[model samples]
Target: MLLGVIGDDFTGSSDIANNLKKAGMSVGMYSGVPDNKIKLNKYNAVVIALKTRTIPIKKAISESIKALEWLKSKKCKKIIFKYCSTFDSTKKGNIGPVIDAIMKNLNVDFTIACPSFPDAGRILYQGHMFVNGVPLNESGMENHPLTPMTDHNLVRWLNYQTKGKVDLINSLTIKEGAKSIKKRITELKKSNVKYAITDTLDNQDFDLICSGTDNLKFLTGGSGIALGLPKVFKKKGMLKKSNSKLPNVKGNTIILSGSCSLTTNEQVELYKKSNPSLFISPEELIKNKNYHNEIIEWILRNSKKRPLIYSTTLPKKVSLYQKKFGSNISSKIENLFQKIIKNIYKYNFNKIVCAGGETSGAIVKALMIKELQIGEEISAGVPVMWEPEKNIKITLKSGNFGQKDFFSRALKKL
Candidate 1:
């Protein structure tokens, strides 16, 4: 493989894979660290999707390093540790710690830290991350059920997560273009900086960041930076036109969401209007271990505009569930969704749409889906994937990525 990407979650894996495939490189996305027995064929880019975004720091570091070693075995020359564009994390993070572990395992001194995706309303400026023109702390991410981004200043946030020094390359220097940014990175390395967060305002900033870091063995950022790497690889004759086509899947469609983000709450409400929707609550989930049977029954009853099953509720109710059911409420809900998805798959629902990072990861792993063929984009940072052998079409959406009507729009895409 020319490039190996370690994504923090399943939806993130799809995001980078979608971008690389659009750049005309064949991409294969895996659910988690592949077993040694599984065969991984040569691809332009291989993304190992891991569900470590909100996990414990030590576990995240261990899993990320394992992924790094696996990618190295594939003889990948370059690696990108992809995280959310919103820089979703707590003070103790899987982001900073995983990056630190990867750098240590690879024996690299300096690497870039950028979590900017301008097209999706995520940008970093003056070393602080922003969402939709608002500082990250003020954004809805601050209220995230897990890994609330309470600090907007990435320099301070990252510093809390790692013992090494974290610095910044401001946007003013970036506007001067790639050469200037390159000079700044060289100076930072000379001063013994381990991680430097680069400020990005738009696509032009992404271009400069990519150019400045292309020679480095490791790059850490969102899927947006992966967009810039393809051009560099193409210039070096490492890319080819790929059959990244969306297969026509004809079957009953089902939309499932397990995210409690503010955006996903809005999407669930909008989708409920035109579709038969069922809300899954923690009480119902914990009380009834066979709660998925209710979901299967509901889908069978109302199969008209696709069945939408969501665990997305308001922040207050989410807090109540977490308080009442304990901290494992999220895992319980994910296990419930996994059962529901497994039961529904027996009916052969070809088109499956998942709306959260952890939820998507659980579903993919439960299905034992090892590799997926990259397909067309349903929205920014979201794509429809194809399991060629089983003839199943799946769409994985990041929690805060799509618009209000994303659920309905994604259905029309298939």
Candidate 2:
């Protein structure tokens, strides 16, 4: 099977390609366009990774089909259009046209799948795999490289969920129920509902973020900055000066991120759960020699004077609502967002580092209730975040921040 990746914005395209190659797939990777053509006979599957923000709705639609036409010209039958879920926190830019282009022009026989649920299925394109809309059981692929799509089997997997559950969606007149699982986001604010969110290449929302408030009491995890970044900072060094209005490292501050299954509200619950997954460890994260406490303990012991926090943890779904949807989720999910806003004082110590635009954006959203002034994020990551929000200063960095064994060549600024 042949695989091709397009686009490089935010390091998303690379993320998918790397994941696929790790699975032992023969994948060809490229960034941007201008070359316009590839020998299709050499490959079976093609992925077009476009940054929805840079390419507007119209351009995305037109160029997406242009890509498909090029792929078809190469006699390639299977084409996958993948997009990154990340962008500036402002939520500007729309790729619906890209999806719409696929839906409208794609051959009925052509298989398509959104990159969501990356862990549940085979990533024919990246993390999970799929072919002709069918997910391959990676384990079973050795014997049956191509699994026949039986009607019943297809039906079964469509509604499949973790464990012994199925997300069956029936025709009209059938509604599902959610009686037991409860949401706790209401405590955050009015946004309690969690819904999958998408960004369109529009500047209105970003304008709102930039215009709404300033002088924000920013809060974020070290991972978003310390671990998630370092791509761009690799060259400049840790203490390099930036043009952003806000300070890169908030002195004597410690922010936590990670724990994918956790949510924003759940993050606050870190102090309550006693299990401490926000700044601590989960079952899977503790396997390393550090046991997920390397930075946490270090900070508690050695961070009495350090100004900037260099720790990280992935975000997780804390409450039931965050588990089902995500930040893009609705009021039932977002309500918990307000909790962060009102509870800002709980973390007010020195400075802040709302890392990861998404997490930082949420913090900004929460603080809006109080009229806080937030500094802007400075863009600079090597692979990821090449372009960040304008007006606001962000320290952009590549996704592989902590990967480097030593300091970067540009650390002379320190």
Candidate 3:
């Protein structure tokens, strides 16, 4: 049976996939599936791993609905499992964990707050098996029931979560943050069915919903942590504020901006033609309609064995929205983790490497994995191994570990 795992990220999905494979299972994982795109028929079962640092319940549930709709059309029996992005959200959201509660509300299969691996992106486990937060076999593994995620784990996790189901859809309980977000979202949903972050009611009251914006702006700011937004991102003024005393920059100090999701205008089209096919994937991924789904399908099609590149320039104001997203997103632990986790997962990748500290910390904290063990004994960075019944290992970093050539160097290895 083929198991599909989807996460708010790519690395976490990979870790679990690696574990499942080690446990002897056939798994296919992918992350960052654009709405209304991708075919689920390639795989039988499906899993959704919510990254607290990247995706929130508001976003995950919404995305899950879209994925479920597509899956149902493709005859996929989905068992969405809400796992941690490695941060402890109990005291933050007034809800429990983040993902599971949504599952409970959506009436999905499983939901629970699993521990996050602290290692940045290193495979930290061997011969271990965990299904539904329980050991499938004793003494054959060296890892815990729950896996942790780093900035490096997001890609792999997303891949594993969506490709298949590794265990029975079940969980013990939900965390407070999960409860809070679920409640607030539920209330909001009652008033508004669409979870999209646009509030047409008021000018200043944009929904600002989505997993990415939530973490970069709200949760990260609330923690008072100095996360550096990618330098490549060049957004405009006012839109880029900082949580610090003076400038309340949305994400860490650095941000990857100055890019657009699609091309329009002359300048955008110019860049689009220049970069024809950076990444290519299976054709089955593009079975959906619309540009959003088109992009996701394009990504899936381009992700076979090639690399998925996040453009630095072109489309003009892509960075502007990111800055807007970072500035306006709610400042709370739950919100920040939700956005960060989503960022990590939504971007599909197999082997993830990091070059930021705040990103690393956020990934570690979101998953709630304590033993990340950095410095000294940590030669190749820390890792939060979520070796479920799949075969994927996630590497993590503090976001600035690889200096400037981080993403490039990592790509070479891939």
State which candidate has the highest lDDT: 1
* Per-residue alpha-carbon lDDT of candidate 1 for residues 221-338, written as tens digits (9 for 90 to 100): 9998877888888878878668646668888888989888889989998888877899887788788866788778888777656899989887778888889999899888888888
Tens digit per residue, CA lDDT, model 3, 1-414: 222334443333334433333222333343333234544333333433334333454664566555444544444322333222232122222123334333444454422222322222111122122322433222111121112222222223332333222221111111122344345444544553222111111111111111122222111111001011111121211123222111111111111111121111222233344333331111222332332344444545544433333222222232353354443321222233334334444453323333222233344444433221111111222222322222222344322122233433333332
For model 1, the run of ten residues with the poorest summed lDDT: 34-43
Q: Estimated TM-score per prediction?
A: 0.96, 0.30, 0.31
**lDDT assessment of candidate 3:** 0.29
Scored by TM-score, the top model is: 1
Model 2 RMSD, rounded to 1 decimal: 20.9
Off by over 4 Å in 3: 1-4, 34-57, 72-78, 88-90, 94-101, 105-113, 116-412
- Per-residue error (Å), model 2, residue 82: 0.7
lDDT of 2 by residue, 1-414 (tens): 222233323234434433333222333333233145444333223334343434455775676566556655555423445443221111123333344455456433112122222222212222223422454332322121012222222223322311112221111101111111111112111332111121111222222221111111110111111111112222323222222222333323333322122122233343324322334323223245443345444444534332222223332223333354443332322233234323432433223333322333333344431111112212222221111121111121222222221112111111
TM-score of 2: 0.30
* RMSD after CA superposition, every candidate: 1.6, 20.9, 21.9
